[model samples]
Target: MNVKYKLNLDVYKDRNYESIIVAQNDDKSRIIECKLYADSQPVALSSSVTAAFNATVNNVIVAENVPCIVADNAVKITLAKSMLQLAGMMQCELVLSENDTILTTQHFSVFVNKSVINTKSKYEPTGANLATKNDVNSAIETASAKMIAKDSLLNTSTSINLTSLEDTEQIANGVTISVSNNKITLSGTSTAAVNFYLKLKRAVTLEQGKAYCLSLQNFANIANSGCVFYPANSQKVISSSWLLSEVSAFKNAVATYTATTSIIIDAIKVAIATDRIVDNACNLQIEQNNKSTAYANPDLIKSSIKPELYQAPDYTMHYLYVSNDYDEDTDGFGVTKFNSILSANDSITDNNYHNRYTIIVAQGTYTNLQDRYAGLSDVGLVSYRGVMMKDYVYYESENIYNPQATIIKWDGATGFDKSTLKSEDIIKKCPFHLDLNVHTHIKGFTFDCKNIRYALHLESGGTGYATNWVVANCIFKWGGRADCVDYADKTTVPVFGCGHSFGEVGLIENCKIIPTHCTIGYQNHDNADNSSFGLHMKTGSNITIRNCDFCGTEIQARTLKGAYSDTPNTVNIEKCINISEVKKMYSAPAERCDWKVTVDGNEVE
Candidate 1:
C-alpha cells in the first residue's frame, strides 16, 4: 500500500520519517510488534507497556503499542520512554477480516525524507448507498477541491465500495449529493436521476451539470452519531454517545465511514439490510404470551422514547376510522387518546404537521374511492384503529350533470344514502382521497369487516396525490371473500390483505393477517385468473414490513415491482411458531428462504 497525500512542503514544519504499526500473526487477539526503518540504529519498545501509560486507556478501540513518534531519524522508540506511555496506548484494530485475521497496514513511511504536506492521506471519500443529486454533487466538489490542494496523490482508478444503492450497479461519477432537512438531492448538468443510474454501469462517468436525481437511503449499524467532515487527513471517528445527545442505531452502524468516502445512499441501505441476519423469521421477535383471538395489547407498539428512534412506520399518519368523539373501551384510547394528547399544543398545523382531520368510515363496505367527500383533506397522521364496518353504503352516485356539485353527507362521504347510484358518489367521486399523508403512524387496532368486502381500501393515485400511509399492528381478516375486497358482489380483485399503492409510501408491518395473508384479485377476478397470495406488494413504493406474525396465512409473499416482500420464503410451517396454515397457490419471492431471519437470536417460531 502507498501513502496517498497531497504534496505540499509547507504543511509540515519538519519531519524525518513516519512509522505505521501492522499487526502480525504472532498474537491472535493482540499485536506484538511495531515496524520502522532508518539509516542505522533504530529505537523500539513493547506494545503492552505503552497501553499502561495512558490516562484513559479503556476508551480507545484500537490495538496496543500505537505509533508514538514521527522522528526524522528515530526509526523506533526507546523502550524506557515507550513503557511510560504503554497504559494510555492500549487499543484494538477492527479491519475487513479474511479468515478471521486483521488486514490494515500503514504505508508512506518514507515521507519523513520527502516533501509531503498531506502526510497521513488524501484518501477517497466513502460512498452513499443511494445518493440524491446534492449528495453526489457535494461529494464530487469536495473530492475535487481536496485533490487540487494536495498535489501528491496518484490519479489511480480505485474501486470505492458503496454498500447501499440497490437496482443500480454503482454510483455514477459527477452526481452531486447533499443532505438538507432530511432530504437528499442529486442533480447534474446533463443527466437526470434515471440517466445517472444508467451511466454508473460503465466506469462511473462523472457528469458536469447534467446529473439530476434524488433518493431516500438509510444507514444501519452506525455506532457513531456525528458526521466526519474529513476522513483523509485524520480518521478522527466519533463514537462517544455523550458527545452526541440523540444517537440512533442507524448512526451507530455507519460510524466507520467518514467524509473521506463518497455517499452512495442507495448502496448503504442495501448493505444495512445484509447486516441484519438471523435464521428465524424476525429481525427482532417478541411473543410474550399472545393468545388466539385476543384483543390487541396496549403495548403492541411500545416505546418510552418521545419520538421512536429507528422505528418503522416512522413518521406518517392516516385517519382514525373510529371517531375521537365516540366512546372508548375498545380503543383503550390507543391512537384516539394519543391524538388528543398530541393535539393539546397549538404549534402544529392540520396539514403541515399534526392534523385533527381524520377518516370516518360509515358502517358499510364499498369497492372504490368514488365518493367525492369520503376522504381526509391534507392531514398528517390520521388515527384509525379499532373500527368495525358492516352493511353500510353500496350506491355509486355520479353527477356529470354537475361536475362541480357539492355533496357533504353527515360529516363524511361514505354513509347510508338511500339515493340511486349516480355517475359520481360522494365517497368514490372525482378528487376523492384515500390517504391522510405525512407523519403518519397507526397502531393497535383491528378492523373486522363482518364478512363484507375487505375491511380497508385505498385508491391508487387519487388525482395523482402522493400517499404517506403507515398501517401498523392492525388486523384485516376474512379479506378474500366476495363481500370483502373491491366490491363486485362476486368480483375477486388482485387485492393484497392490505393493498394501497400508486406512489404510496405503504409501510405495513407487525400485524396479523388472519384467514389469509393477501390474496390476488377480489372474489370475482380470482375465478377469472385463479391465484392466492398471502401478500402482494407493488414496486417503487418505499415500503418496509417487518416483525409480523404470519402463522396460518394462506399465501406468504410476492413482489410486483421494486416493493419488497417482507415475508421470507421456504418457510417450514411445522417449525413456525403460532402460525399453522398458509396458502401460496402461486410462487413466492425469490431468495426468500436463503436469509436467516432472526431477532435477538430467537427464531420467530
Candidate 2:
C-alpha cells in the first residue's frame, strides 16, 4: 500500500512557513503531492512549464534538480534514497520555470523521522540491476565497430613501399629508399634533397570550392615537416603547408624535403573532414544506455544522470531593491533590476508588521527641493542598506572622505511652519522623521543639508517615543561656505535633534559632521536654541556616540530641560575627535543631566 502526503504551498508566503514529516529510508511507498498558489489563486501549469525539487541537508546541497511530475496546478515527486540518507531536517524548495525562465519559487521544510531498524550492508547498488562483465564488453565492441565504419567513409590513405616505386615517382635522383622492420627510410649523400610522390591505394575525388583538412601520422620527427596532396587524374599538387597558414596545421603534415638525413615513414593518414565521428558515436551510445531498465527506474535516475549544477537565489521574498535608472515594466526587484525606493517602502501593507524588510539602495544621488520633507518618514522595522563609496573609490583623499558617494540632498527646514510648537508638526518638515515604537536603521549615505535646520528629527512628544535606532557610516554636511557666520534671520539648528518629554534610546557610530559656517551663540527662537552643538539631546533620553569626527562646532552635544525635569538626560561620547577649537564637549543648561566623554578609554573633562 502507498501513502500520499499532500501540501498546499503559497508563493507569496514566507520561507519555511509549512513543513512535512517523513520516515527515514522509506523510499518505495511514499510520495509527496503539492498544490501551488499565488495570491490566493491557483497557478496554472502548461506544457511549457517544468518543476524541480531541490533540498539541502545540514546546509549542504544533496538533492538538486530532481524532476517533478506536473499536472495542472499540482506536482508530485517520489522520495529519492539519497535525500533520505540521514535522519534530520531538510530545507526544500520547488522551482517553477517556463522556457528556462523562472516564474516563482516556493520554499518549505521536511523533517525525516529517525528509523529504529539498522539495515547496514556493503556493496549495495542504488539502481535496478548491476551490469555483468560480459554485458560491458559487448557494448564496447559494438561501439568500436560503428566508429571504424564511419571513419572509412570520410578518410583515404596510402602506404609507402620503396621497393615497388617507379622511376617517374622519384623526384630526386640522388636520394634512395629502403624498408626495414616495416619502417620506410630515405638515405642520401650530403646536399641531396628528397622530394617524391607515391600513388594512393584508393582514389579520392575533390570537388571545386570545397575545403579539406590534411594530416600525417607516424612520420619522421623532423624540422620544417609538411605534405602535399594530388587529386585523382589531376597534375595539380596541393601543398598542405602552403594552402593553410595556421602553424598547427603545418606542424602536423609531413615535410617535403630533408637534406642528408634518413626519413622514416611508418604510417600516415590524410582525411577530408565534414563532421565529428567520435561525438556521434558517444551520443549514440548514450541514447542506447538511456533505454536500459536501470535508467528507466525513477528511483535510480538521480545517480544515473547528471544535469547542470544548481545555484541558489540571491534575494528572496524578504528583500526589496531600489534603483533610479531602472524600468518597472521590464525589471523586477532583486531579480534583474530594481525600482524606486519610495515605491518599495509604500508597498509594505500595514498588516505586515511581523516582516522585517531590507531595502537595498543602489549608489546614486537623491535630491528633493519641495516644501515637505523628502526622506522616509514613520517607517518601522526596516533597514536601509545603501551601496557605500568605499566599495568603488580606489584612492582616498580629503574631499572623497567628506561627502559619501550615495547622497540624499534636501532643503527641508524646521522654520517653514513655526506657528506650531508640537513636535509632531515640526518633525514633518525635516528630512527623516522617526515616531513612537519604531526601530529604524540608516547606513552608507551622506545627508546633504542645504543650510537646513535639522537633518533628522526623533519625535518624543505626547506618549510618542523612538527607541532602538542606529545611524552608522554616514556624513552630515551643511553644504554652505566654511567662513560664513551671518545668522540673523535664519534659525540655528543641530545636525540631529531629539524632542522633549518621552524616553528614547539610539546610537550614532562612525559618523562625521561638517559644519561649513562659523559657530554662533544660541538664540531662542520659540524654545528652539541649540545652534553651536552638533547633536541636541532632550530629557529622559539616552544616546551613545562613538568613533565620530565633529569639525567647526562650538559644542559637540547639549541637553535641554524637558517636561520631566527630574529625569536626567544621559549622553556617552567615546573615541570621538574634535577638529575645531570647541570649548566643551557637552553642556546642560538645566544642570540636571549626566555626560561622559572619553577618548580611547581615558575620561576627558
Candidate 3:
C-alpha cells in the first residue's frame, strides 16, 4: 500500500509531529501534503507565488531548493529515493515566495524508518563494526598520557646554589675566588685569559638534543667571560659555549644552549680574559625550557580552560564648563565651573590633553574672544545659550535647529587689513585655530562679527592640508558694509576663510550666513565688486556645504597666489537654499582654473 501523510503548517509557528514514518529506499510510495494557514484562515496562493521544500539530515542537506506543487493554500512534496536513503530523523521546511521575496517559512520534522523488506537496496546496511565506549575512552586516555609525559620532559626545572666558594679552583695562576653574601667574586690581576672551575654539589643530567636555560643571578663585570658545561667524569664540553654578554640580563642573566650528547653536568667552567677589578656571580639555575618556550602550568590549566566572566568597566564623561556667572576660584578640571572659554581651553595641557573634551558654554553673550588653539583630538564646542544644558547635550541636533542663544561678539574687521597682512597674521586674527589632522565639532553658537572680515577661520597647524573640520548649527552674521570702492577693503570679507593651505575635506552644514548686503557694489557683473562671499575656497581645496541658507552671500573660489597647478578645487553644494537675488552662486577665475561646482547632484557650469 502507498504511504501518504497529511499535516497542517502555520505561517508563524513551527510544527513537530509525533513521527512521520517513511521506509528507506521508498520514493513513489511516500507523499506529504501540507495545508498552510495564517491564524484561523487558510492562506490563498496567487499564480505568481511559488513554494520550495528542503530537508536536512544531521545538518547535511539531503534535498535542497526542490520545487513543490502548490494549489491554493495546500502544498504537496513527493519524496525522492535519494532523500530516504539513510534512515534517520529529518528537519524539513517550506518557503513560500513571490517574485523572489519570501512571504513565510514553516518548519517541521519527519522520521524515516529502516525497512527490513528492502534488503537488496543499495542503501542497505553493510554490518560493519563500530567503535565502543571502552575503545574511545582508552584512546583518549593514551593521548592524555602521551601529552603529559612530553610536557613534563620539556618544562622540568632545577636550581643549583653557588653561594659557597670552598671548592672553587682556578686553572690560571693570576686569578682568585672569594664568596660573600651568596655571591662568588673573581678578583685578580690577570692580563691573560683565566679559567675557573666550580664543582657542583650533586650531578644533574641533561638529555642530548634537548634545549636548556642557564640563568645566573646578581651577575656583574663579566662582559668578556665565556662559560662551558662539562660532564661528571670526563672533561669533555657537553653544551655549546656562550659569552655572558651575548645573553639577556636584567637583575639576572639567562642563556640557552642545546646539549650535543646526553651528559651529567658536574662542573661549570668560566673563562675570563683581560684585567678585571672584580667579577661577581651568584645563585644559578637551569631548566629544560627554552627562552621562547611556553607551556601551561598544571595549577593554571583548570582556570585557563574556563576563565572568569568578563564585565565592562564603568565610564564617566568629564566636561569643561564655561560660564560668566561662575566664580573664578572654581576654574579647574573635574569641576563644573569655568570663568571663560579661553580659560577652559588653556586648562587642557599635555598631561591631560589626549582626553575627549566637550566644552559647554552656558547661556550668555561672550565678548572676551581671542584666538584659541586646539591641537588635540575629540574636542567639541557646544553652546547651550537659549536651550537647556541637558537637552542640548542629549538632543543636540534637534535643539541646534532652533535659534542659537549663545553669541560670541567681536569686531574682527576693525584693524584687519588683508592686503598688507602676512599669511601667519591672517590665521592668528581668527578666534579658533584647529589642528588639521584632528576632528573638531562646533555647534549652536552664533558668531556676531561686528564688521569682522571673517566669522570663523580654519588654520592648518602647519600641515598645509585641512581635514575633519565640522561646523554645524550656527550663524555667521557680518554687521559691516558689503559694498566698497576699494576691492581690497575689509567690507568684502567672507564669513568663512581658510589659512595659507589647501583642504583635503571640510563640512559646513545646517548654518545660516547673514551678510549686511548681498552685492558688493552696483557693478554686479564685475566679479571683484560682487564678491560678497560666504566661504572662501582655496585652490585645490575640497569643501562640502549642505543644507545651509545663504541670505546675501556667494561661495567664492579663488586660487592662492602660489598654489599647486595640478590639483583642482572642488565645492559640493547639496540641498542648499540661496535666498538672495544673486543668479550665480559661486565665482571663479574665467581661465587657468580647473574648478568644479556641484548643486543638488548636478554640476553647475
Candidate 4:
C-alpha cells in the first residue's frame, strides 16, 4: 500500500509574514503565494474571514510530463490574525490555481480570535455561583462604557434573574432595590412618571416622578388587586400624586373595610327589627295557610270570635250610589248620602271618603254647581280619586227659546231658575288636577258645558300636580261661552278658561269636543287677544291625543303655552282630523323652542 503524509497547520500573528504557504521547496526554496477563500468567497488580506476550509496542492502538467513549480510547491495556506476577527466556527480553503484552473487543494477550520461586537451571545455562568458581585459590576461598567461611546445607544437592554432578593443595594446612583416577604421594590428617581403594571398590586407612585417596581407575590392580601396602571387625571382610587399622606390614608381605609363589616352586621339587625316580615299572600301557599282572607274588617273578626256579636255595614268596600228616591239614614249605600249634586260632592270630597268609594251617579240633570257643590270657587273636585258618575252628563233640550239654557230647582225653596252652565261649573265639580292627594281618573263621562266656561280644566295645586289620569271615550259638548272675557283676564287666571288643561301625562283618545262658542280674546298670535283652545297644555309633557275628532271648535285643537323661559315640552298628536293648527300660543315675548309638531304625516318646520 502506498502511504500519503498529512499535517495540520494553524496560523497566528507573526512578525515575518501575515500569511504563509506550506509546501515542498526546490534548491532555491522560493515561497509561493496561495489564494485563500472563506466558504468559496475570496478572503482579502485586510478583511476578516471566519469559516471552515479544505486545502490541496496539485502538480499541473505544463508541457507533457513537465509539472508547474509554483503549483506543485504551494501546499498549505495560513490566514492572518486580521482575517480571523469575525465570530463563528467557519471552514476555509487554500486553492493553488493558475489562470483559474484547478491545481491542488487543502482543508482546514477557522474560528474567531476574540469576541466580536454586534454579535449574538448569551451568558451561561452556572453550577457554582459563577457570577459574583465584581463580575456583575464589571459587566455593567463595560456595557455602560460602550453605550457612552455610541451616544445613540443610551437605552440598553439588560436582564438579571434573581433567585433570592439578597443583593438589593444601590445598584446605581440614587437607585435602591428592596425585597420583602411578598414584594420586590425598586426605587429610583426618574425624569417622568413611568407606566407600570404588575399582577396583583396597586400602582406604585414615585415621588418627583420616580420609578418603582412593586412585585406582589401573594395577591390575596391586597384589596382590589388588579393590573391597572392609571395615568395623569385618570379615574382611579388613588390619583396621579401618591404622597406619603395619601399612602397613610389608603392604609387607614383598608382597616376601615374590615371594621365596616361588623358595622354592617349591626345595621342589618336594626333594619330587620324596624321592618318586621309578616306572613303575606305571596309567601303562604293555599295548603299551608288556607284561612287567610286578607281583608280589613275589625267587626267581622269580632263576629267570628263571638257568635252573639252584632255589627253594621263596615263600609269597607266604599260604594256610594246616587238615586232620587232614597233616604240618607237607612239607604246609605243606595244614594242617600250622594243624592243631590251638593250631597254627592260632600261625600266624595271628604278626605275620609274621597278616593275610598266608587261614586255612582244615577241618570239625572244635577245642575247645582253654585247653590250646592260650589263650596270652593276654583276647586271643583280638588284631590279626588276613584271612579265618578254612572253616565257622564246627558243634555236634554228644555226650551227652544234658549236652547243652550237649562232650568233647575235650587234646593226646592227658591223654585225653578234658568241657570246657564258655565265653565266654572265643570271646574267646581270634576277638575282634572295632579297632586299627591288627587289621583282622579274620569272615564266614560260626558261633560255638558254649553254655557259654561270650560269643559275640563286642569289646575295643579301645591308643589306636585295630579298624575296617572286617563280620560277616554268621553264627549265634551258645547264648551265655553261667547263672552268669557274674564278667562282671558288675569283676575282668575286659567280658571274655567280652556277646554282641557293637560298638566301631566294624560291620554285623551277617542273623544269628541265640540265648542259652540269660541269666546272672544282667545287668539294665540301677535297683537291678538286671549284664545280659548279646545285642548290647552300649559307646561306639560307626554300628553298623547290620538284618534280624536274636534268639529267646529274655536282656535286650535291643541295649543301650548311654554310659560316663557322654560324647557320645551313634548306632546304627541297623531291621526286627528277637522281641527285648527296644533301650535304654540305665545303669551309673552320670551325664549321659545321650535314646537315639534307633526300633522298628517308631515313635520311642522
Per-residue lDDT tens digits of candidate 3, residues 1-605? 01112374321135332332332233233456676654445666688888787765432356767899888668877667666654543456667778987665554456554452344643333211111332222222221112122322233232212112223435365667654322455656666766666644323556788776665543444352433222222244454454333134432345667777765664555556556433444434455656553111101111111113421112112345566666846423334346566666555542122234456566567766532322211113232111111111211111243336677776533344534333223223444544434445677778775433346655443343434566788887765422222433455555675542344466788888877633321011111111122225443556678888877566654442333424555667888787332223223444333446677778766
The root-mean-square deviation over C-alpha atoms between each candidate and the true structure, in angstroms, is: 25.8, 26.2, 33.0, 41.8
- Judging by lDDT against the true structure, name the best candidate: 3
| lDDT per residue as tens, model 2, 445-507 | 687764443565544333324345677777877542221134333434666655522345667
User: Residue-wise lDDT of candidate 1 within 1-605, one digit each (tens)?
Assistant: 11111111212225432323222121111122333322233433223222111111112112233443333321222122222222222212211112433222221111011111122333201100112333333232222111111112222221112111112223333333333322223333222222222111001111232221111112222232222111111122111221111132222211221222322221111111112221110011011112221111111112223222322121122222222233456332353222221221112244343123333222232322323234433123233221211111111111111112212112222342323322122222221223323334444344432222234443332211244655454544433333222333532322233333333454545555554423432111010111122224322233444555544433233322232334332222222233433333332333222222233344333
Question: On TM-score, who's better, 1 or 3?
Answer: 3
Q: Rank the candidates by TM-score, best first.
A: 2, 3, 4, 1
Cα-based lDDT for every prediction:
0.26, 0.40, 0.47, 0.30
Query: TM-score winner among the candidates?
Result: 2
As for lDDT, the candidate ahead, 2 or 3, is: 3
Query: How close is every model to the real structure, measured as TM-score?
Result: 0.24, 0.40, 0.36, 0.32
Whole-model alpha-carbon lDDT for candidate 3: 0.47
Per-candidate clashes come to: 162, 3, 1, 37
